[model samples]
Target: MSTEESPVEREDRWVLNLRGMSVTKITVDFRLMLFLDSDWEVAFDASVDLSYGTAHANPSVLLSPESQGVAGALALFGANVVSAVAFKSGTLRLVFDNGHHLTCSPDPSFEAWQVTGPRRWHFASLPGGDLAVWTGSGASES
Candidate 1:
C-alpha cells in the first residue's frame, strides 16, 4: 500500500479597523497548528490615533484598572508621554490595574513598536511597510 503526504501551507491573514474621529487598524497573519489544540503563531501590524476616542471608552474604564496603574508605571519607567509613549526594546510592557502586567513584543527584525499613552494608542511597522495599530485593550484616550 502507498501513503500520500500532505504539503504545508501558509495561514490566512485578518485585518481589523476601528474608525471614527480617531482611526485604529490592525492586521494579523497567523497559522493554526492542526495537530495541536489552541496552538498558533501570529504576526501582527497595528496603528491607532487617540486624538478622538475609542468606541468603548466608558466600558474600558470600568473594566480596566490596570490601564490607570500602567500609565503611572510607564511614566516612572521614563516612557515619553507627549506625542506617543515610546520605549527602546521590541517588547512593550504595561501593568494593569490589578497589578497584572502584559508585554507585547514583535520579531527582532521588525521595527520597534510605538506606544502613545496621551493619545492612548500604539503602532508597529509591518514587513510590507504598512502600519498596524495595537488593540490589546485597556488603552485610554486623552
Candidate 2:
C-alpha cells in the first residue's frame, strides 16, 4: 500500500510531541517502539543533545533492540524526532526533562495506553547524565 493510503487501513497509531524546557541546553534519552502490524515490531534508544539555537538535536550513538536496526528506520521515515512516543493502541505521551508528563489515550478509536515514571534522572548536570523514558501499550493480538 502507498504511504498516503496506509493510515486509512491501519486501525491504530499516534503522534507525540516532547518539548524541552527553556533551559539553554539539555540532553534527553529516548526510547521508542514502532508497532508495525501484529508480528512486526521495532525499538529505538538514543541520547539526543539540544541547544537553544536549534530545534533538532545531534543524536549520539546508543543501543537499539531491533533486527533491522534504528538507522534504517529513521532513514525510512525521515524522522528527526525531537521528542515523540507512539504506541500501537494510538496513545501518545510527551514528557519533559523536569519530570513533567502528559498523556493522551482515547477509547476504541485508537489511543489506548499509559506512561509512568520519571523515577529518577541520573546526571542532571552534564551531557553524560543518565536520562530515560518508557512507553507501554496493549499487544496487537491481545
Candidate 3:
C-alpha cells in the first residue's frame, strides 16, 4: 500500500499530532507509552495519556550506548522507524536509525496496543470491559 493517506483517515482518539516531518522530540514518562510530536497539525499514531498510573511499566524502552549519549536518542525518530517488531513476551519494539530503539509491553491485565489501519491505532474492548491492545505483528499464521 502507498504510504499516501487521506486526511480523513485521521482518528479522533489520537488527540496528539505528529507531522511525520522529522520528529522534533519524544517523551517517555510514568505513562505506558512513548509519544512524538512534529511540526504540523497532522496526526500520526498513538496518543496515550499517562495519568492514573493504572498501567504497568512492563516491556521496556531501552537505548543503545549511542542512543544514550548527551544528545539523547531523540533524533532516532527523526527518520521513519526502520522496523517495528513484536516479541514473544508480548513486548513491542520500534527500531530507528543508529541502532536506537524503544520497546513496551503492556501488562497482561492492561489493554494491548492495537493498530488497525496501516499503522493506525484503535482500542478493542474485551468482555468485562477489559482490553487487549493490538500488536499488529508476530504470533500469527500469516
Q: Give the number of the best model, judged by TM-score.
A: 3
Give one digit per residue, the lDDT tens place, for model 3 in 21-91: 34444444322223333222111122221111122533333332222322344445454444443333434
Worst 10 residues of 2 by lDDT: 121-130
- Best first by lDDT, ranked: 3, 2, 1
Q: Candidate 2 at 112: error in angstroms? A: 9.0
Better of 2 and 3 by TM-score: 3
Off by over 4 Å in 2: 1-82, 109-142
In candidate 1, stretches whose alpha carbon ends up further than 4 angstroms from where it belongs are: 1-85, 111-122, 125-142
Give per-residue CA lDDT, model 1, range 1-142, as digits (tens).
0021211111221121111112122222221101111111112222211111333542222111222222322211221111111223333333322323233444445543343322233444433333344444543221
Residue-level lDDT for 74 in candidate 2:
36
Q: Rate the local accuracy (lDDT) of all candidates.
A: 0.26, 0.29, 0.33
**89 in model 3: Cα distance from truth in Å?**
6.0
> Ten consecutive residues with minimal summed lDDT in candidate 1?
31-40
Q: Which stretches of candidate 3 lie over 4 Å from their true place?
A: 1-22, 32-79, 86-89, 111-120, 123-142
Single out the weakest 10-residue window by summed lDDT for candidate 3: 44-53
User: What does the lDDT come to for candidate 1?
Assistant: 0.26
| TM-score, prediction 1 | 0.24
Per-residue CA lDDT of model 2 for 11-44, tens digit only, reads: 3433322222122221122444433221222332
Instruction: Please provide TM-scores, in order, for all candidate models, with all chains considered together.
Output: 0.24, 0.22, 0.36
lDDT of 3 at 120: 38
